[model samples]
Target chain A: MEKTTHVTSELNINNIKSFLEDIESFIFDCDGVLWRADEAVENAAQTIAFLREQGKKVIFLTNNSTKTRNDFLHKIKSFGIDCNIDEVFSSSYGAQVYLSKINFQQKLFMIGEKGLEEELRPLGLEIIKNFEKTNDGIDNVQHIEPDHSIGAVIIGMDTSYTYQKGVYAHKLLAENPNILFIATNTDPSYPVKNGKSLPGAGSIVTMIATSTGRKPNAIMGKPEQLLLDLILESHSLNRAKTCVVGDRMDTDILFGVRGNTKTLLVYTGVTKKEELPSFEYQPQYDTRTIGDLFTLFQKL
Target chain B: MEKTTHVTSELNINNIKSFLEDIESFIFDCDGVLWRADEAVENAAQTIAFLREQGKKVIFLTNNSTKTRNDFLHKIKSFGIDCNIDEVFSSSYGAQVYLSKINFQQKLFMIGEKGLEEELRPLGLEIIKNFEKTNDGIDNVQHIEPDHSIGAVIIGMDTSYTYQKGVYAHKLLAENPNILFIATNTDPSYPVKNGKSLPGAGSIVTMIATSTGRKPNAIMGKPEQLLLDLILESHSLNRAKTCVVGDRMDTDILFGVRGNTKTLLVYTGVTKKEELPSFEYQPQYDTRTIGDLFTLFQKL
Candidate 1:
């Protein structure tokens, strides 16, 4: 395992104060950093309020594509945190912005849920409609020939993922090499309400990747630059002064490292204290929980 | 990229005569060698007929688990080849034999088609039935706890593979580390009627494997020792006098090498003339077609 740099000491008042002073905006990963599933972490609400009180921009960037932006805002507000729909930046939203920026004019062959479809609706993007309406209905495995009009294939968290969908995506990629293949996120699994995690879009993408022999041209999620770019485009944030806080090292901390922003690792999520040594790129600061940063906020 | 031993000479009359005299039984891969998908190669039927007339025991071995032994026999007969159901050995049959050998008495969690189920019927193995009767029906995503009575999870080619099936398999494996995870074959794709191939058992098994983070305990198919063991147990053949013949090196040819049998490579299928040098275990004999082996039979 590759060794990564580690912050040996716990962030106390002086360290927290300095860290807080250096950053103007805070980007948070929701599932692990803010709360586990639906239950919020201790002092999670307080930490966000404190950051807002200091006039720091708080952005909740999540890779959960199952829900729409409004759904996330509702969930966050339900947790007693002041949030706006615009403050919630999901991978689906990032993909919509990206497609618009590239001026993609072709129809998208979508293999996701209504949330993803809803995201595309705002952009006026046309979609190759699904054959099946619901899981209860027939999969009309129509043996449909490859459609040249379909220039892109987008996939997210789809519970109704079927063989037909995979076959169609494979056919499109096989027919045209230039067809854009984009995935919302590739997180292997996501935590559910019961503490157990379910297979994420990454698994679905992997299945299609195995069948088509083509990887996604772009993964519009954390660790990738697109999500960060989406955040930067919407908010005026100084990269040098911004800090990204998350539990997972691979997606969260690596996202910060790739963007050249400060990163704070919280131990309440996927990453553990013992596993920090094996990381290839360590975060800049380590704390027990997101609430631990409150001591620094108090010092100010 | 590993260099394997290669036989550079084409088998003429003398070489074929000697090769024929040395092998009492011939194990053949059905796809690519004897036939390509449904159509038999130019002289495949004639070669098999000649071998049978010479009193050689021929086995039609395939990894395709979609069809039963009777189905294979019917197809072979349709191709004008003399064959019996007893001569056909599919991966589904291999799994049945393996489970019987291990005295697997517990219920099996089956993720395959009717062909695989038919193979298990003779052994009196009970299966934890799937929730959905068809692909259009509800997946039943039943949150059934791990049933300790289930000892093995067998997977083959299933077009109706769903997220619920993957989740259930993962849960079963997670609940019991000792439970057997058996896959029919891991061939990424298999040839269909149109010369195009569809995702095979390997892809479905891979999806479950990815979600479970556990590789199958046993993969009962070509390239694995279990398939060769099943063939040897059913037939009276001397290892020194047996020749395994096929087109693909990774599965068919490798099976022969691992079983300590001589192998004959045919160029009528997947492995072409240019691919011989790159194999890690090259066949001992090379021929343009199965009909080329007739030169030895003529000498007899």
Candidate 2:
């Protein structure tokens, strides 16, 4: 649990001023709000520019584990929004921070892509290929065995995943009760080519967690507070001033409500307009679309 | 919904005699009562033989979709039990029957292995690779597609599955609101080479069904009356003379309750002995073990 303390500028007037008066730093959800299914939202770049002119610091946050921060920054730039790599906060980075905090020492068995591994390596954790690597007397080719030395199991998206991996993870979890389980995100689906979607790492994490009866220690993405805490920590921003603005209520709005930050729901991404009135926790600001936020800001 | 018709047989003696006085046939759950995992229960063969000697027809019913009727028959024979292939009933067989009843024409996008597909082919249903295969120039692989042309979506055990398969299933389900969703079994776990496991086809079916908001048309496996109906249809066995004996309450005892047949719970498999007395629905005859049932029959 991290303390929330960011303060927004009182003199700033945005079009959504009536709803988001005290908001300063903006946290944007990448997948749906900023861009959707390989297409950037219309006027998305201009709106980001307008927010920057208003002296609001922006952070691109995403629960998607498939793409690294550098990859996301590149994609965001391609979408016509100028953003630095440091302004990106991914769930994978949060996972690394979480692992570092807990001081988990065992060889990591990652079920994710290279980005996830890159984040965890800074903590001096070695990634073991398989459970066979733990075996001491094995004369065979490079084998990853679970020798009761591994400290935690980390799961992320791996397209080449197999049933054997799940079985091995189950075995390791069953063998070591103290071992921690960490997941990057819990989004069930991710965008693919031609507007199609694929089952993300969340599905695999769900499978392993459900089977082992061991809930993950933490999910480092939006809807979870880990990434938000890391963002505030890195920028020395107070939580109250830093409002999370995005499209999806489950991730963006929930993150705001959980962190006690003002939330702005933009109807430009995954969430539909009709879904707002029924949300359990209402957002501080509700705009017809993200592009509308720019017009509202100008009026304010 | 199926009718629960109480069946009675003359084999019930003393305190249990009245319940069996009118039973003419016997239904037995294969997995637990007849066999544990892949091992046959001791004297289980003799008990079925004795029931046959008493002019009681036996139906070996199971919810496990990994094996077909012929496979079950051979396995039973190897355990020294004489069972006809026709006497065995599986959920896959029932799903095929359900599909045939509706005159399904389009190739089935089967999410199962060879056994499930083999069962469906005899029903004149064509088997498509996946929803991706239907991507002809006309279909266009868009966000929304029509699924009325699809005959059915049959799900079963698929160990060599990928995320793409799940995505395709999700796409097909989203496309056709009226497409039939059929699952082989609802067993959460299956016996693997190591031990009890998570995610058989039933688990996958559950995930897809939950996501799509569609209930399966019919589950033909154990605990469902469809398999029982098939057994009764094949053997011409009267409901009044049949009894279902097995270990698992949800599958075996519930099957008997649904079919209105006598249920004998043999404590030699999945269900533990301590769990019997507190069960909400009590089996007609509670044997200490499967061997005890044969000993009692031999004494009679």
Candidate 3:
């Protein structure tokens, strides 16, 4: 394989066991490492249970903005994995926390799904408009001048994305240079069933960026420090003893490198073994799957 | 007052007669110079008629894509100006000629008003979809995958632009890297009635560029050399003897500068005297208005 050096340099079972022994807390990415779409990866549930049984703090972190924290908790529980709502750190959840932390008081203009709205609405944050919820006929479309009341623009993935929404957001940002612009995640696309993918939140965010010529102040997702900071905030996580686990090298491994935490790459998701050399940054450790980590637990 | 140097150095009425004596042909930008919105500028008609009486080859050009050549001729006639339809050059007309020059055989996916479609259809070109003509209920929207038959994407201003239309164009360009990407113009916005403006073709084009990460191959409008090329192609224009007259420094004057044509800036619309010095390139001549040129004709 092209990545022979990195592949052969991976920690052996004994080395992995020693590394696990030093880890005081763990952060796990939910999608590719533990489950694909609606199906759980083989032995993934048991592997997490084994880590929890060892008395290590565990948290589920994901960049998927389509789901609320409760939705993630429900999905995680159905996989026979014990996940509290507080342990979930979805991008929408992270956005909610970040907005609250900054004490954002103005009306939030959004180009996102109901999940994102659900996260912000309960906190008493006012949204400028919800096109999907309005369900107005296309004939009812009207050109509105820029409204000065809009204070921030937040974007997430919505199956119902429209040009009118893009225009309204663009006009607002163009009129007010100080508006707080934020995107929940910038993943190029997300995998669907049958190995197909749909344009992700990042693509939608890009549309807004192209229109307004402005980048988001914060992208609340993996590889961005905001999510990591939120995960460690409540848990009092020690970066030196924290191990971040995920399937993708770009989002997960790079996330760990940036945070100074150990990272383990599982092959059950996006990245392949042969693709390692192509990346400028490599994971600290990589194995066949999340279940492979069980060997370390058995040895302990 | 800020542009005093450029203004003072500009040819006076006596000097203007000498300058006009050498001009064999002229390309005139329509809006803001000869007219503002739907109203003609004072003496604009007589100035142009005087130029024609001097046996000068004159062409009426505009970057506005909302009108066809016939539409322009009609508007010009309404202004009490004798103009031939063949002497009018609109962004839509330029796009039609460009596609024909390239021998384009595949269907064009358009994001524009009916005027754009009207120009291309007469040239035996087929359009993929018209967002306005469909008149489908917005609630009945469905996602259709990229169609390979779409060989080019052409964008202009469209009040009916939808997110679905933007995504479809993006997917086509993303999937087929070689698909000819073209836009009518990149004017940030177009002026409407009551001194207001709305987002223009550039905004819609920017959305696709942001989504696909590709700039247009040909933006068929002012400030680009393509339009100048089109103007000169039929007339066998001598760049040295050709004079370009307009009101805006950014588009019209810049177009002339880039094309190596002598340019005359009229202060009737858009660019004010204070804004001229900010431009790196200056027009060769400046006057109070287009009617000021008629004074040169009278002196002769």
Candidate 4:
């Protein structure tokens, strides 16, 4: 196929294995490289098992803010993949950490999924004006009251995203420029089953950005250094020895390149082989899929 | 006292009067200049009357997409300001004209106020899915359906702006790159009663822009030449003899400056006299308020 002819120049099984020899740690993106929805990638669980057997430390990093570290851990374990709760670094987990790092003790306004709220609320933060949580039969923006005590506004993917929320957030951010704006992830949309994708945290964040004319003070997802900082802080990760692997180039490969970590892009997720030429960042290695990496592992 | 001290350098009553001597046509911004909400600005109607009595043509121009030309005409008449329907130009009115100019004949999707819909629907265009119109008690995005018949997505300020509407628009635009995306205006917020402002059409427009990663094909409002083109085409407007009077420098003054017409900034609206030094665009004259310009009109 075209993919074989395309990647033949710079990538092959032998070259990929030789490149992995010096890499002591392997960072795997959960969504596309390991599993899509409930189904695991072909031979992906075996690939991680083989890597673990080879004394290579494996880490699961994701920009998905819908899930907390515990949620991701449970999902990873169900797939027969070995993962510790501490080994999982998700944007939702990073959000609470980021807030704690900044010492933001004031009330928090959340516009994300339940998992994001779950990870954040445990930080002992008071939730502001549950206007959204308590609908109160109010469909009008004027009826939607404002909470002056709100200090930071955090956003992720919410199935219950509404226009009323956008207006209220706009009013708060506009009136008080001192409010801390945080975006858990700016992925415009996340892919679902059957090739259909729904709006992501970025879609909600963008609505606020348009209304308030402000960007997030801190972005807690991949492509940003915050997640990598969290991953590196706990573990003695060497930029040269740790290889970052993911499906997307913009978020995964770029994150690695920016952090000086070796990156290997897999074909199991969002990006394609042909797209590698168009992107500003290039992965050190790419294969047919994450399953292909398992084949190299079997040879050794 | 602060404003008087601020304008002593490049603005004065004698200097302002001399600059207005050569102007034959006056283009006035409706909001903050002529009126604020239901109440007319102090002496704004008298200023227009004085200018009209002096044989000068006065036209009402506004970037507010929430109102149609006819609606503005009524509002202008309510304040005892003499104005023909043709003299009133709003962003919503310009939007229909822009669409017709491009010969766009297809089903449309909208995420704006009722006035924008009123101005646009009269063009005889078939509207796409009515998920918003017929809410059907469905709050979830997955339950929301898509319409393939959509050819263009127009945005204004929708009081009913919901996350569901934003998601559907994002889906249609993402699926079809050929779809026309238009923004009625980019005014961030409009000043409301008691010094408070609500999110404007631009907030809704920005949300879609973020969701789709695309800018509008045409922005029909102040500071853009489209409105001026429509104004010039309809009337015998000589750019050199025309002067645009308004309170906001970013929109009204910037619009006039770009159109090669003289600009006069007034203190009756959003901008302050002290802030004039920081802006890139400068008006030929600045006074305490629009009523100050009427003072020189009496000398004739």
Best by TM-score: 1
| lDDT of candidates 1 onward, in order | 0.79, 0.69, 0.79, 0.78
Per-residue lDDT of model 4, residues A1-300, tens digit only: 111112322446557567668889988888888898668888888888888887888999988887778888999999999888878999999999999988888988888777888899878988652475434121346455578799988888876666667667777787798998899988887776656567778877877886677888889998899988888878878768998988898789888888888778888788988888777557877776777767865665
Query: How many pairs in model 4 have backbone atoms within 3 A of each other, for residues 3 or more apart or on separate chains, i.e. clashes?
Result: 2
RMSD list, candidates in order:
3.4, 6.2, 5.6, 5.1
Q: Candidate 4 on B1-300: residue-level lDDT in tens? A: 111222322445456566667888989898788777667777777888888887888888988887778888988999988899989899999989988888889889887776787888778998653475433222346555578788888888777666677778887877788888888889877566656666778877776787677889889998888999898778888888998888888789888878888778878788998898877667877676677667655664
What does candidate 2's lDDT look like per residue over B1-300, in tens digits? Answer: 433333322233353444435567777777667777667788888877866776667777767665666777888888899888777777777777777777777767777766677777797656775444333111222333434456667777666455556656767775577777788987755544323453555556755664455677767777778878777777787776777888787678878877777777777666776775555666666665666645654455
Docking class of 3: incorrect
Tell how far residue B204 is off in model 2, in angstroms: 2.3
Provide interface RMSD per model, one decimal.
Answer: 4.8, 8.1, 5.5, 4.2
Better of 1 and 3 by DockQ: 1
Regions more than 4 Å wrong, model 4: A1-11, A37-39, A77-79, A132-144, B1-13, B16-18, B37-39, B132-143
List the candidates' TM-scores in order: 0.91, 0.84, 0.80, 0.89
- Going through the candidates in order, state the TM-score of chain A alone for each one: 0.92, 0.86, 0.92, 0.91
True contacts kept of each: 0.28, 0.12, 0.15, 0.51
Per-residue alpha-carbon lDDT of candidate 1 for residues A1-300, written as tens digits (9 for 90 to 100): 323455545678767777778889999998888888668888898999989998899999998887789988988888888998778999888888989989998889997777788888877767875754333211223244557788899988776676666667767875578999999998876566565655667877877777667889999998998988778767978888888999999899889888988888899888998997777778888899998877566765
Every model's DockQ: 0.38, 0.16, 0.19, 0.34
Total colliding residue pairs, candidate 1:
0
The list of candidate 1 runs beyond 4 A from truth reads: A1-9, A132-146, B1-3, B132-148, B295-300
lDDT (10s digit) by residue, model 2, range A1-300: 432333222222443564444667889887668777678887789889988987788999988765678878899999999899999988887887888777766677787767777777788878864444222111111132354676778887665555556656755775578887888987765555565555566777766765566788878887988888889989888798987988888788789889887777777676776775566666766665677667656665
Report the number of the highest-DockQ candidate: 1
Task: For residue A278, give model 4's deviation from the true position in Å.
Answer: 3.9
